[model samples]
Target: MAASQAVQAKLSFLFKAANTQFASCPELSNFYLHQFQKTADHANVPLADAVQRLCCARCGALFVAGINCKVRINSIDASKRRKTPGRCRNRVRITCHACRHPTVTNGSTTTLLKAVASPGLSVSVAPPVDVPTGKKTKKKKLDLQAMLNQKKAPSPSSSSFGLDDFLSSL
Candidate 1:
């Protein structure tokens, strides 16, 4: 337990240092962030949700909203989500600008909405269905000959226009 506390203190210090140095020297900040992760891993300590949200999983870079990352809220349709057992109701997507890697974190709708609606943070809602990420659809074979032979609607003739007769009567 003493070792865990030491590791926690070290992690907090590293995280703060990383954030402080990030604006002036990003490389050094990234180093600190990497060290933070390494220390946590070595101590077998799990990172808190608050800490995890501000770090990039790919490059170990500090995530600053709108500066180094883009944060968006993805809401799943209730009916669709219920059909899929493993899917989350609401997902918060944080895309790291440095590596262009997107990390998705699932949470309650109210909490995610509150986080996104906070002042100074830009919020964008994703489409209900992400079509591109799903499986590719098979193209159906078209019967050109059958389509060409199909009967078409008759075109209206000039005699069909009774406006001239109507004007003459008026």
Candidate 2:
């Protein structure tokens, strides 16, 4: 069956169940159904399952789950002394219903939990470059006579006083 059709079927089942469970109140049923549909659409999963997972028995806040879930294996390079060949071992992502913790499933067991610390896990955020404010430092104006005298003092044929010589020095 198509994914959309499966989703609709599951939603209908949840709606009916919710209505029956809530004493068949039309307004309550519609409200619950709307909430279930919204949660399912956001999570891209079955409506009933998503509703069951998010709705806390104690406090009724919708907890977000299955975020930043990934499974990766780093292959060490013998020559370079660095783990370069990073590969994803599993593709199936799972989220815990009670705590909203994301995990990567490998077979029946969850290999990587959402809280496990790993190298290269933190995204590299470049620091903002220092922008020059409107304030400009006052530069001393060069004396033309002094400059000309200094140039004359140096040998003209030597070509050491040129812009190219200054650049090369830098």
Candidate 3:
């Protein structure tokens, strides 16, 4: 999957470069874009999903950190590190210039970097680089027994307006 992801990223870069070089040639740009998509789809790379993290969702425009997109990483909280220590914190945000589409991805920087770096040397065919929705996920079931044992939050004030109250007031 890493190898395929790397291939797709390379193709994206190629098409982006081509698109700029042949700005006047709309057909050439469209050809490059479609060719990229076709190659990625054939490889089963999920390029659009990967590209969604780094490209414009609306226009399928390429994102260059400072050039075409605004790439920024959210601040990480030091206090609640262990309580929720997953991709939920310190998200990577990519805002595209062409369509003004803002994309927020959790902990996807490493995979993107790996894909870009993979083309230089040997392909990283090993697992670990994964798309957001992969097959390894498991359904987390809540422990009802534990929930019952734990003290619940105090109920909201009873004075709060009810549906009947709002309807009557209206």
Candidate 4:
């Protein structure tokens, strides 16, 4: 398959896996979706692809292990987990498996999915899906009459210096 198609297929798998993994864990899903949105907002990937690549494993910290992207998972102890009130259930605290950095979780996966999957979600901002860039056309033919009319138009100083006189002087 072409490079673009391959990238798309990998992204599709990541999104499908994320959907399946997060289906039962809404909180984890929301957290990952939010992280994906934030990362995609800043990263090199197109907004849509960034969103699609966002995934997490049973433990939080945004999974990208099998995906084409370069995200690394940092390990942390489950004992360090914290509890924040008014948050989604099944919330687990952990650090980056790779970097060992600390982060917090908020109940957001469901909201993220709703926002991304929604038909009305800002279609103008998202990139077009599955259109081959190689097939796109550029350059348009100019209108001959329009070009002729522009050529026929007089210069600003033409009226001050009579056209016939100017031509004669030239």
Q: Return the candidate ranking by TM-score, descending.
A: 1, 3, 4, 2
Name the weakest run of 10 consecutive residues (lDDT summed) in model 1.
133-142
lDDT of 3 at 56: 53
Q: Which tens-of-lDDT digit does each residue in 18-90 have in candidate 2? A: 5565554534544565565664666576434445544332222233333212323343344543232323333
Indicate the TM-score of model 4. Answer: 0.21
Q: Model 3: runs farther than 4 Å from truth?
A: 1-31, 34-45, 48-52, 76-89, 108-170
TM-scores of the candidates are: 0.56, 0.18, 0.37, 0.21
Winning candidate number (lDDT): 1
Q: After superposition, how far is residue 147 of candidate 1 from its true place, in Å?
A: 64
Write down the lDDT of every candidate, Cα atoms only. Answer: 0.79, 0.47, 0.61, 0.46
Q: What is the descending lDDT order?
A: 1, 3, 2, 4
Q: Model 1, range 40-125, lDDT digits (tens) per residue?
A: 88887877788888888878989888888999998888887777556568779999998998988875745557777889986888
Any residue pairs clashing in model 2, and if so which?
none
Q: Write the per-residue lDDT of candidate 3 for residues 21-115, one digit (tens) a residue.
A: 54466445545655666666667665545554544555555556876679888865767544654524577788877667788877644445566
Colliding residue pairs in candidate 3: none
lDDT of 4 by residue, 56-121 (tens): 322333544333224333333334323433323333333445345443444334456567767766
What's the residue-level lDDT of 89 in candidate 2?
34
Give the clashing pairs for model 4: 29-109, 30-108, 30-109, 73-98, 74-96, 74-97, 74-98, 75-96, 75-97, 75-98
